[model samples]
Target: MRAEVDRFRRGAALAALLGEWSTGPGPLYRKLADALSRVAEEGALEVGERLPSERELARSLAVSRSTVVAAYDELRARDVLDRRRGSGTRVNGRNRGPRGDGRVRGGQGTAIFQRLIDGPGPAISLACAADEAAVEVGQVMREVVAKDLDELLSEPGYHPHGLPALRQAIAERYTRFGLPTTADEVLVTTGAHQALGLLSQVYLRPGATVVTESPSWSPCLDIFREAGVSLVAVPLDEEGIDPNGLAAALAEHEPALLYVMPSFHNPAGVLMSSARRRAVAELASRHGVAVVEDNAYAGQNLSPTASLPAPLGAYAEAGSETLTLESFKGIWGGLRIGWIRGPVGIIERCARRKALADLGSPVFEQAVAARLVPRMEEIGERQVVSRRQQCALLERLLADRLAGWTWRRPDGGSSLWVRLPDGASADVFAQLALRHGVEVIPGSTMDPSGAHDDHLRIPFARPRREVEELVDRLALAWTELRRHGPREETPIRPIV
Candidate 1:
């Protein structure tokens, strides 16, 4: 059987998924073989997916080709892999067992984006933690074309470090928000998603550790997992990530990177306190750990009285390695414009990786971004009002229907982090929810250790009437789920 699977063309992509291998009590090839087996068992390296060429794998892993050969030989000997002439090596499906419905084993555990997208789409997509394009998006595009059309049309249009003026604009935006940065420090990417992936490429290594919040952006968690880094998940609270817990992780794990969403954190919507931000930067700097501050929702706060602190990059000391990721995606999900601001050297390295990944971001998109980034605050203020109204509707509907369901009031973001009743798996609830014409992300999906099984992330981006109907249907579904019981035994399943 030819099993359909996503292939990792580059060794880096595969390495990211492999995560950190244990450095203890074994020969290098033996350890490599065991790690491959674990990834295969987890369903990440799907049965029948071709492994990288040994020489290519060795180059990517920075090991000798002989090591990869020995590792592949060991896996083949154990019946974990199938090696045939001219067919290349692939995971052994006979070893992985049956794929009755054509779905890969353990496929349910993959990230939302990583899952296959076939068949009919969902009726209502609350699983996406983003909103429709802003009114300014269209306006910006028109303006950019009118103003820069001739110049852009005449150019070759490949800029690995990003368009110079756009990079300057992003740098200025950071400066206005309290971080002194130069255009040279910026490297633009397709979106914040790619920004994180690029950073993982630069920083993560096999057998290294990465520390992040327990409930982080699910897709980013997938990136870290792919990098073959051991992830240490620190729990979060009202003040956002616990400073003491972070300090302990830094001291203990000495992670290669500390990925954080300090501003209006995704899914949780808990902003890290100013003091905590400072402490986190201090801890990372002291431990010589690089920090990737996901500032995607930095300026979306809706509360009239609430105040957000400066980007963690501002708090990071001069010599520390810190990268701040920002994007227009928060302004509009379809907007594919984001940039990373960090030290010049790191930005250069990331630019090279970005070039390898994709030649460059779309020039027209960057042109529009350059025109709009300076006015982002103006754009965000309106979005804040709209989102606040939506959030109010969500709260009222939940209050009327689902009693005892609780959530923290986020200052600003597109979603609510809800805590479901005890024993109610969000994954199972999500499966139940889909049948009712609504979709939600299981909190376990965002958790590194799958411990937030009782949580859910509900995006409040749709119209008030749609949201109202969704909540009503959700109540009906919950009632039915309780009466009939959940279908799946596992807490999570593929939610593509």
Candidate 2:
């Protein structure tokens, strides 16, 4: 029984390590063999780890048994793998020493990072939702250097609580949004991603439960999972997370934290109504659950005349809510600046964690971000118009080329939460799409429960020409998918 369990674990690890392996050039068997060899070379697998049987691996990879057999035979010929009658297949003993760290390394997220740092390949990616830097970033950066470079260089340059000016800027921005805040209430991090990580580290423990929207951002879910906390997903609707569902989750699970994106949800792209925000605040407060409202998309209002509600912190009790803000959506992803607004105690705790993590974010970047914070409204106006135009173009292209696929028009955010046609599987379609030179995120990546297999999150923030090309490639992939019926479901993978 123990051996069987180990076999299952190895099979799952290999499946994740070989992500999109079939998309590369070569015959299917060759690609399989090469992917296996690559992972072995990278020390991703143990030197003597036993591999799953060919039949089992074939089922996991959604390929025929013959394909697996051929690949294994090739590996055996090259002495990279060994197979015996009853012992199954194992990595060759002569390869290298065992990796004794005992850490589970490879996953879809790692695969995405590898691709990103290696530079863009042949595929047109709709996986990431970030856009180019705001035009004012360069000018502001120059001004910051010209004015503060001398003094900033003279200092030791370590600020765990963040630069005083940037903290004040962030606090003032929150105050302007109707949530009165002080500089002491803010802790800056590398980005919203790091902010979430610090909160997870400070507030959660292993085996603790966290309640979040079902289709929340994948990276956020990854952070909480890494912190060793269990997740309970509450469903979201057109008006954001269902209040009744949240109430039930809180009542039943007594979660340590409730994480939500109340402004413009990441994949769903729906803005929570003001009444819903109040209900969320009231329910969380009543249950004594610490709330983390991610307002990363707060200023991304695509509608010019829309009066967006204040952050959820404004509606919640004074010390119960912590809000996270970032420059990713309103400014640029490359800026890597974000802050947490909360009670002084919570801010201090998170700051301690931040100090342990990175000492501090780059002082130069924070200096520039401080100047840019005051100009967010000006920069966001241009972003709103560009995103609106791109969203419209994507909608028209989807309607024209891929009939029967449906999605609600997003109020804000850069991605559309699209439901595939009846009987379609997003996991399989995503694989097919990658083969056709375009990449998209399957809904399963965002859903912790793996229930939304038929949904896809398609980002429309790319250049106009790339968007058109992406649609054309998607049309081809969809046509091919229709010809060949959906296969067995693949493992859910993470994306940005």
lDDT leader: 2
Could you tell me which residue pairs clash in candidate 2? none
Q: What overall lDDT, based on C-alpha atoms, would model 2 receive against the true structure?
A: 0.79
TM-score of each: 0.77, 0.89
| lDDT per residue as tens, model 1, 376-448 | 8877776777888888989889989998789998867778888988667675566456556665567766877
| Separate clash counts for every candidate | 11, 0
Residue 15's lDDT within candidate 2 is: 64
C-alpha root-mean-square deviation, candidate 2 = 5.4
Question: Where does model 1 exceed 4 Å of error?
Answer: 1-111, 114-122, 487-496
lDDT of 1: 0.78
Q: Model 2, range 1-496, lDDT digits (tens) per residue? A: 2223353343433665565677865677778888888777667755667788877776545466777788888888778888867877878756543565333354334444555555677887665777777789889889987999998999999999999999999899889989898999999889888888888987899999999998887778878878778889999998889999999999999999999998789888889999999999999999999888887887787887787788888898765755555655567888898888888888899998889888999999999989988878777776788889989999999999999999999888888889998957676677667778876666766777766778888888878998899999999989977876323323222456
lDDT of each: 0.78, 0.79
lDDT of 2 at 364: 95
